[model samples]
Target: MPAVLSPTYREVCLWQEQVPREPLPADPLPHEVDVLVVGAGYCGLSAGASAATAGATTLVLDKEPLGWGASSRNGGMVIPELKAGPEKLAKKYGQLGRDLYAEVDAAFDHTEALVKEIDCDYVRSGQLYLAHTPSHTPHLRDFAGELQRSGQDVQFLDAAQVRERIGSTAFDSAIFFPKVGGLHPAKFHDGLAKRALAAGAIVHDRTAVTGLRRQAGGFEVQTTRGPVRAAQVIIGTNAQMDAAVPELAKRILPINSYIIATEPLTADQLQLIGPQMMVDTKNLLFYWRLTPDGRMVFGGRNQLDPVDVPTAREFLYDNMVRIHPQLTGVAVEYAWTGYVAMTLDRLPHVGTVDGAWYATGCNGTGVSLNTWLGDRLGKVVTGQEPPPAFAELKHPAIPLKPLSSSYLPMVGRYFALQDRR
Candidate 1:
């Protein structure tokens, strides 16, 4: 097995330090509920909240503590777009593609509303998509044009303007989306979980679902604690899937992504990078932003192999210094990793099979997409409305499932090479 980080290292995620830990219930989970949702991340918790609000007896289960997965470990960027470019989507799916983009735009609106309702430390300072190579500039321009044509707010920045905004000469150009923003992910998760509980959802942590099978009225879900029977089950486990849901495992690939956070910087040091969520245009991308406490939280897809805190700190720090040589000897105080699920189409999917509902494959846009999809899934399960267009789209299983473990690393390598070019 790959070396696992010690408990101290695992606590390195800066988000975990921002909120007080909520205690789980000692009372045994009821014999059953109207709905049993798996995974306690944003999706599961949001789904639980929605279901309970609609008067369903909802219970959320997670293998680890609440908000312990990518929900809290991510870079806290609330971007409203997908990995697939708008032009490509337009060419392939036409009006449907455009509609999907609109849905993503609305997701940002939904997120903004939630941030306000929850009163978390959210900033609408916007996002910068920097071009890592000169050749990538035209693509950024095209993307900006597509956004403008679709009636979205955007601005294109030249190399000099990019340097002025982010204080980085590494990028050739950039595209700015005024509506994109950042937040304290763990705090947001905590607020959402509290809302779910307040809405009458029981959340059980350290309860991993071991087996799931169809029963007479609903489904029988076996967990570490015991068996749970529900009229419906919603699998919100994005990239952290194991054997609990074999069907979902075959449809998504779980790739490791890492991040490193530097010690809180001086106000002068913070001036080197302005306060905006920033990401570079690369197949294997690099994204960074300033934490609310003024730390530079930098992250990327450096490698597919499992990494410990020390190794990740070194790798990400070296890359950070390359982007901003002024930070050459900066201290990296934290390091952590999260699993991001990638689908064959690089888009999120929501649907049902064998009387169970699921929403997964966020492809790195989980902060916004997952939360939105979770609410939609709740409505679907409650018979409130139909699934959205993206959910109705086919979610095909990945090819050659047996070799994915060996093949994904090679795929990562190919993307890394492309990023260099």
Candidate 2:
């Protein structure tokens, strides 16, 4: 008999298999709310929870099932990382740059608190960042010292040490982040949803926001169910913001990230690759880790802009074998794809656009950054505090916005070529 095919994200995600996402029951669409949050991913739910706790009547609307986006589809690696390091950031924004880094550190702290509260299978398994080539080794070592000076418990690992940690000689040197860890994304999302509901925020799944117009009092948000008047609005849609607010969408480029899980590995295979979050330094990088159940979950970029799932699976599988040839013939048990928001400046942006406040452009670090910024935005919406330091940073505009899609594939191919060298 022909073998049955494995389930892809079109059916169910491996991480989400444990915490099933059933559609939310239909609910009354209130005519008015103190705050309306569009998108029910990590950012929206977090914002809604904070706003409701601040005594606002908050409503969170999503076009699909809860955690249906990148929030649940990510690799679950929690790194309090920004694209620009402290030095470059200071050079760019002065004292505000220091505050930006501090904010990310606080985000990490928030995740640590949530991991215990959520009871997700979170392991404080350390993280390792590898240098892809010898030429790139020294820069990473220096960066480790920079982070150490800034009070992070980061250490530079030599070639022998890296092999000892990961059991692979594919890398020359590496940096170890002891505080970095991994968790079940879907479980965390489930816990967050419960938190939002307990805090009195109403979450309406499958309710798409069609239009957002600033009115005299505040804003008239048109959803598929009906129009709701909102005293304040927060856009947390990230990659899907185009459908809700077109002008705001122009600020971000949606890039597709794909992942595949190999069947459970043997004890010997597991020993060859220690179970920690592993990422290599390349323009087009790869990250992989062993799931709690022993499957090797590997993820990376697609070769093109528009995702072809079959092609993504093949590409990732071949690359995984290239990195660790032990599992060349292992069957892939799962596959999935999610869109990551990339800003021109390679950093997240938080502030207003089209009169509605927003926090987006996670740049592949959404697991921690999104939740923290969303909480801050929620508080700001209810007058709890001022705009976050990120608000002071510029949201770089894309050149030739209408033609970005046409040029994305070209740029992706360029990055792929650079990865080869």
**Alpha carbon lDDT at 200, candidate 1:** 97
What lDDT tens digits, residue by residue, belong to model 1 across residues 73-145? Answer: 8988999888876777889888878777877877778888899888668998799999999999998899899
Tens-place lDDT per residue, model 2, 233-277, is 999988777767877788898888888887789998898888789
Clashes of 1: 0
Using lDDT as the measure, the top candidate is 2
- Candidate 1 Cα misplacement greater than 4 A, ranges: 1-11
Listed in order, each prediction's TM-score against the native is 0.95, 0.95
